[model samples]
Target chain A: MANLTAALTALPAFLMVSLLLLAAVAYLFRDWERTVAIIAGVYTSGLAFWFWRMDLSQPTQMLLGRPIQLVAPLTVGDFTFQVQTLNAPVIALGLAMGAAAFLLAARASQGHTFVPLGLTLLAGYSALFMAAEGPLAPTLLTPLFLIGLSAVSAFILQAGRVGRVAGPLRLLIPPILAFPFILVATWYIDQIALNPQDNQPAQMAALFIAFGYLLLLAPTPLHSAQTSSAETAPPVALTLATLLYQLAVLYMLFRTISAFPFVVQDAPLASWLEWAGLATAVWGGIAAFGAVHAGRLWGYSALHDWGVILMVLATAGARSLPLALFLLGLRTISMFTAAAGLSVLEQQTGGLSAASLRGAASRLPWNSAAFLLGGLGLVGFPLSAGFPGHWAAFQIVAETDWRQAAVVLIASGGAIFSYIRLARILFGPLANRSLLRERPLSAAMAAAILLISVSLALAPQLLDGPVSYILSAFNG
Target chain B: MEQLFAGLDFFATETGVLIIMAVIGLMILTWDWRVALAGLVVVQTGVAAMGVARTGLPAQWAGVQVAVMLIAAAMLAISAVQTPTSRSLRQAGNWPLRTLAVVLIYLAWRTIDVTIPVPGIAPDMAGLFTWLGLAMLLMLGLSDNPLFSVVALLLWFIPAQVAVAGIVPHPSIFALIGGLELLVTLTASYLILVDRLPAAARRPVMTDVVFPDQEPKDWGVTDDAEEVVDALPLPGFVQDMVDSGRAARRSQPPALPAPNSAAPALPLPPGGSENGETISEQTAAKEQG
Candidate 1:
């Protein structure tokens, strides 16, 4: 058991090797979708359990009054991977989402490409979260992430049959533009590290880093690629591109901010983030309300959720940090479930427009239910997965400024209206009745996902232990 | 090495090379494939000259720059040639727009200060780097053609690489940058090829239809027959003759041929004889008969 713990301590190395192995296996067994799915499922779930065990060790140590380290840091060639309190939950949520996405792909029969791409994305996110804070780390990891992202985009373009050069160009250009800023930030941060007294460059570097993240995250004005992707890309590919990629970039941004605390203390810089976040949220909600396409609606809702998360981070208060992390976790689960359900619905209907989906509930009841549940959760409705995190964020904001809270409420209300409108369209009179029948495996899997969301909503206490540990790290 | 560079100071100075680079960059903005390829080679020469001046490396190092440029240029030329001629060449006759873009790019570059300076690089060289980078970005924004965009992207990397070389000066980093540049160039070539393939040969890319059930019709048209005839691009005389012939045939009733009779042959047009007779000769022959 002790040896097992020691071996697992080299999590980064293991994860990278596992990524290569899974990709090879997937390629070699491309003809057998079931085998690839099983391999991906075991790997992702194993990583998630490993994170859970690491998170559990702190409580066990405190209760037993002994220094019990379940996971230790591994260092190799100036790179280190330590299971910190903050990243454990983040990594766990990401792996869990990967697991669910892979399972959905398998059940839905979304082709052999999903397993390899999903594993590659999982590895990228894990490495991103595990990257230590230093000049070399950001500089090295930024390019690595861009290369991985480019590969994923290429695959998605190939699988989705997206013939337009614009889609792939849009995906590739932003990272290229963002890379220079990250490199500049790295140089400045290194300068600061060398001479601790130079604080000006640190602040400047933070702003640059924030800008790079904004480009990666695709806030309101820069969000066309994501929406186009959602419309054209396959469900599994869309999930990887938008939900998984967004979460990884957000965590990377968080790590950057945590490394340089002074950047948050800069008043004008933080205020800019606040304003940008607010504007993006309001705009995204309005755009979502006006969207007739189901995929665009999902894209806008994701944008709105990210806007709120950014606002929470912009507050730069210790209290808001944990709330941000909590909301991120909840949003991931809900978004994955929602996106998976949409993918299934799209496959069954051959389209996702309101007209095509009219009265779809009578045909794909499980998918419709999952979509509705996921949408409602994103809107922060009661008994939905996003309720606790969003409610907490509201309370925290209201104590400081009522106006920001009001804006948040309006965005939530707009999202709720959009979801309700979608529900009406989905359950209304049958538009083009067909003989298509839902697959039992996919239906059951989607229902299980919905059940998980409902359970998370009904009992938010399930996240208490992890959230507390994350918060404790911030305090220390 | 310094003495050698001094001997060629007319074109090797920072300001002199920048002027040459700017000219090549503007030529690229014209979006002509042949001209752009030539301009890119010039741009690479400028880069190598500036690199030698800044780093004081031996003249042999310039071979690396020329080699990379030749490889990249070869790839671009192949992609351009394979592309249909109708799509490959475009003329940017809108001089005002081009002029405005250049002015704006220059101003933007001028306004930006290189806060982190490389020890050996002068202020003018840094400014030139900024100018080159912005110009590439402008070119990328203005063009939608994959080949042109790829060229612009490749150009954008050179300025950044040159600037970083002055700062880092490490061979491994240079090697890494070189490899990355090669990868990007190859990838861009692949994208161009994929873009040019026939729709059926390409992978399926699903597009959402705006109106699925509506039958396509010409709006505000009452006479469908006349509209179809009017849409044909034949000469007026030819169309008139065709219409008259069709009407005459449709109006006449078919006569039944006798059981043992051969079908009557129709007369050919004046110049339509099998033996290549001229219209004038046929007319004279008819008159003689």
Candidate 2:
């Protein structure tokens, strides 16, 4: 009974991953992978809330009273970084996203045979994150790395040969172009390890890496592709990948920042980041205005969200970073969920452009609601998880430069307006017309979307705790 | 050792007025005006990118002055052309003449700072650029003409990215400019041609329901309070012709079934077949679905 009470109390922190892993393994071959994934997300999200509320550590210090030391690579060349895994929140998110993706696939009527692999992927990421010491080894990292690799490979394998995406070669180039830069950069970094040095060069390198990913994302006209290739992905798979790229990469980069405060402290670098965020935000907004496609609109909105976060982080003091981490975690999860839900809507038309959505709402009411609320939540619309982070960020800005913050809002208007446009298309007046009506969304898909929105609205605090944990861990 | 490909490197100082002249001459002699125009835009953008991006420019302004002179030479070639080119290729007045105008404008605006409010902070350099870009996008994105919008998008996006990364002392992102421009231009073409599909209304002449004899009583409009012929899924030109033909019913109005509010019709429908009534009824019902 005492154990049961402790488990119930701990539901927000660990139950989500454990339960999800159990269900994923149990139903790895079941037809309800879609439904199962959603259940997992709910538990995982609850875990984030529990962490946020209790923040159990006291006299919180890095290493929790142990002297922190950077593990020196036995040799600068061919050094191995390793640790046993233990983080609860990150594992929970990874599982939640993985499950949510599986659920999305299931919602689309695919078999859930892939659930076990996804669960393993979650476990791998968890083990890396949850360790008493946060250092990771290349060997231990292999499994999680395989998640990204296998996700892409599995999709191609499932596609099985008849590649009909031949409409525009120009449309296909951006995503292809992007991979090489990231792959090359990651390869180069793995080749060499520097002394735990100052932050400036590291910041510069991280900025380049982030830009490499952004190039692949191709938010606006600047991209070489005519079509957003991301539209071809499984909603869940794409969501999981995006969460990994946008927030995970960001967290990794932030962790590295502590080793180089001088970079962040450099006024020129700080000003540059502010400028970059502003540009990204405004550019995203403009693109949103011209966004005639649902996926593109959401994609641009995500960019804007990234910009907002970047701006805040750029301006924030070290003490303020916990808030930024909190927001990033909340949005990464929320956006992944929303993007997954949008996948269902995309299927009815076999596409996801703004025009494709003509009369889409009648078939997938709940899914559309999920896309809408999720987009709003990601953008920090009034009461969503985004709002609190944005509000706090603004307060921080107001102390320094209220005028600039006002401008940031104006630039962010692109996200706000585009989301409104998406809503209008999905649930507007009965003026929408269609010729071949799309099939209605599956119950699992609809349920998953609703759950994501509700979770985001109900308990963003769940996210706050894990973020603090990560920060505390990094504080060493 | 003799350096073979040293000239090819961007850092090589051998690049000068001769190179600029050669490029301008190539634009005039071998290239199409559109290519020339794009080239000109590229050159100016490259210069701006150099100043704004961390890429160091030629150590001396002498090269820049020479480059401008060559640009003037290219403009002269464009103005001298007999054939008009694609608007995108209008480099004649754009480079020499337009460049002059921009210079004058800059001279005037340099004295004044145009700042705008943004979210949560003061207008830093990147913030200022963003405001400018947004304003440009609003003007261009909302334009009725597709081509104009594309041009505006270019104007807005490039400067915006440059401004954002510029203020940082160690700015480094060239692929962003090249790659993004390619994507934006191509996507616009796709949207216009593929996504914004034009609905075709193909029908033979006899399908027109208008009477051939007298001015037709009630103009084929029934007690249903809807014009029978108006209900056909036809483009304006075809619908006009069908209305004029005033022909007999064709194929029993193509056997339209009772309206399912959840299902919307395809692109074209036969005339009559209870079209308007079915649409409004279906739409009203669709809301509840």
Candidate 3:
């Protein structure tokens, strides 16, 4: 165990070394893509298992019962700070995320050159967050995450361009706008210099990060910039990838928020969140009011999903975090399923215009079912994975202010209208030629959607353990 | 009254105003001009809702003022992205949208008063409203497909999150990176949505735009070739970089056929192949630059 911790503590440096090795080899040998992905995934799974195993008893952290170098400093300008490394579980998570990215890269039409790199960065981030001793960890992770997301975004954007609808301007700009915030946040990290003894600054820093991530979850103005680079057939996995980031960001929020309820649970802050959620939901819905594109409709539903989480997280309690985390899983399933169906539809027809896809469902009823199911999830319809989380959120909010709950519900109505409208479009009486030409359904896409929907439906508790485990860190 | 005239006017004092400006600049950079214009309107709304340096009713109606600002923003968004064929219109089309960007910026800055600050949460109302405006602007600007537009608009979250997280080290840094993350996300989304277009199967303006699997034949002749010639040249640095078979050009592709209507506009058969990255597009971009 001690050796494991020692190895794990040195993991960040090891990851950097590995990234170099992979990058060197990846360009020359494309065949290693699958192997890299598998290793990354297994690595993450291992970390996750370790996280569970180590923290099994209480809110305890025993890292292979060993002491690794607590901190290593990097000097930029006058600042000399060592980056902190995290525990096995978080490192595992990085591995897992990387693994997932690896799998996705492999599944993509082109073997993603960026996947291995992204996984390494994500692993580094997880390691920093979970094991690092000082403020530098979060700061380091911030830049690393920015780089990782950008890589993912860039790859996906390239994929989208390759797919068609090239010149996706949306892909490049949002990251540029976000760069300043990162620079500023990094500076703060340097200033705080949180010693290993106290996790307050790091935790609080994360809360702040989460607070910002709430908007990220929704992606309002820079929305086009956010998703302009969607190039795959079923954009679900890609969407899921984004959601995974959101999950991490939200987890950062919940745990941190719990620790600092004074700052987090304030009326003004909560009010801002509430109104923002309402406005975002309503605004996103109105935006989708006459949406013609099926994918666009899905995007609107996504906005609604973010709004739900925003509202739920606005209220502070043990339940809120669990539900918020749970909600993420549901959102993942629902969003991914819908993206898969839409991917199929897009593949069948070339575009997603309303006039063209007048009655697509009548042809591929099963895929349509998946699409509808995803839509249901978006609106938090009963039995859908999206349901329970929203319900829990609403239930909590309603207890305090029914009006707020009503607002959230009204916002949700936009998504429902959208879904119903889509169904109407899919089964419409328009006389235009079938905009959709049938391709044999992709078993992978179908199975993926079915699995997402089924898991969302059957295994609500899959989230329970993780959520509780994360929440335990809150001191609540 | 003393607080109102403290000389640190809302526009001058609030950091979010700058953030709003940054957001607008970024939106213009990424989205179509129409969406960018909507972002401009939100900036105006931020000014109005947040108020001028030291003007307007500084108290008693901050929420309503902000709401009004948001309403204006929403109205502008609807007008800008609304296709010519919609249920009904409270306003005319092209001209109204054309005027929105600069007009809203002027309106917001000239009106609303955000003299008061929300302690512990730096930047005050001006900053707060800017975040809200940024989100609204995106939601409105992305009027192409509600689904797509909404996501694009959600890019506003980056700034909004920045606001809540404060200008402190952790949140600011995280939010900034979040902004970039958003940028990548929106761009990817744009790519994803466009790729979903069935017109893809027909032929590509560039040979490289073809899905590796479906492989678009010789389709994009429309004005692609002509346009390519007129494109701006790539800078020397980029020009030096290697591209596909084609040398980097400083001009646009010549007039190519519309990839959508030129081939299969009606049928959407979603599909593709491996090696999804477009070697040609990158070369084309470099050449066009």
The residue ranges of model 3 lying beyond 4 angstroms of the native Cα positions read A1-9, A15-111, A117-121, A124-148, A160-237, A254-262, A265-267, A286-289, A339-368, A410-414, A420-452, A473-476, B1-289
Question: What shift in Å separates residue B156 of candidate 2 from its native position after superposition?
Answer: 28
Query: Which parts of model 2 are misplaced by more than 4 Å?
Result: A1-81, A84-92, A109-232, A260-262, A265-268, A428-452, A474-476, B1-289
Order the candidates by lDDT, highest first — what do you get? 1, 3, 2
DockQ of 1: 0.13
Q: How close is chain A of candidate 1 to the true chain A, as a TM-score? A: 0.85
Which candidate's lDDT is highest? 1
Per-residue CA lDDT of candidate 1, range A1-476, in tens? Answer: 98655554455656666786887778788778767887787778877877766654553232134343434565644456656666776777778777777766775655567777677777766766766642255533465366446646555544535234544545656665565555556566667778888777777777766666666666666665665566656666666666666666666655666666655564255676677777777777787778777877887777777778777877756677778878877887778778778888887787888877888887888888887787667767788898888788778767768798788788778877888898999888877677376778778888898988988998988877866755554443
Name the weakest run of 10 consecutive residues (lDDT summed) in model 3 chain A: A77-86
- lDDT by residue (B139-225, candidate 3, tens digit) is 344233323343344444433333323433343333344444334444434443343332322222332322222344333212123
* Cα lDDT of model 2 by residue, A1-476, tens digit: 87544333322223334644665564654556556555655544554454333333432213334322222111212222222122334444555556556556655533244444444445445433433321222322222232233333233222221222211222323333333223323322433356345544444445444544344333344331222334444455545545643444444444434443433443254565566666766676676667766766666666667667667766847645676677777676667556655767766666676666766777667677777766776666775647777777777766778887787677667678877877777775534455333345464556655675567567667666567666654454
iRMS values for every prediction: 3.6, 12.3, 7.4
Q: A60 in model 1: Cα distance from truth in Å?
A: 18
Please say which candidate is ahead in DockQ: 2 or 3: 3
lDDT (tens digit, per residue) of candidate 2 on B163-215: 33332212122333333444444443433332222211222123231221112
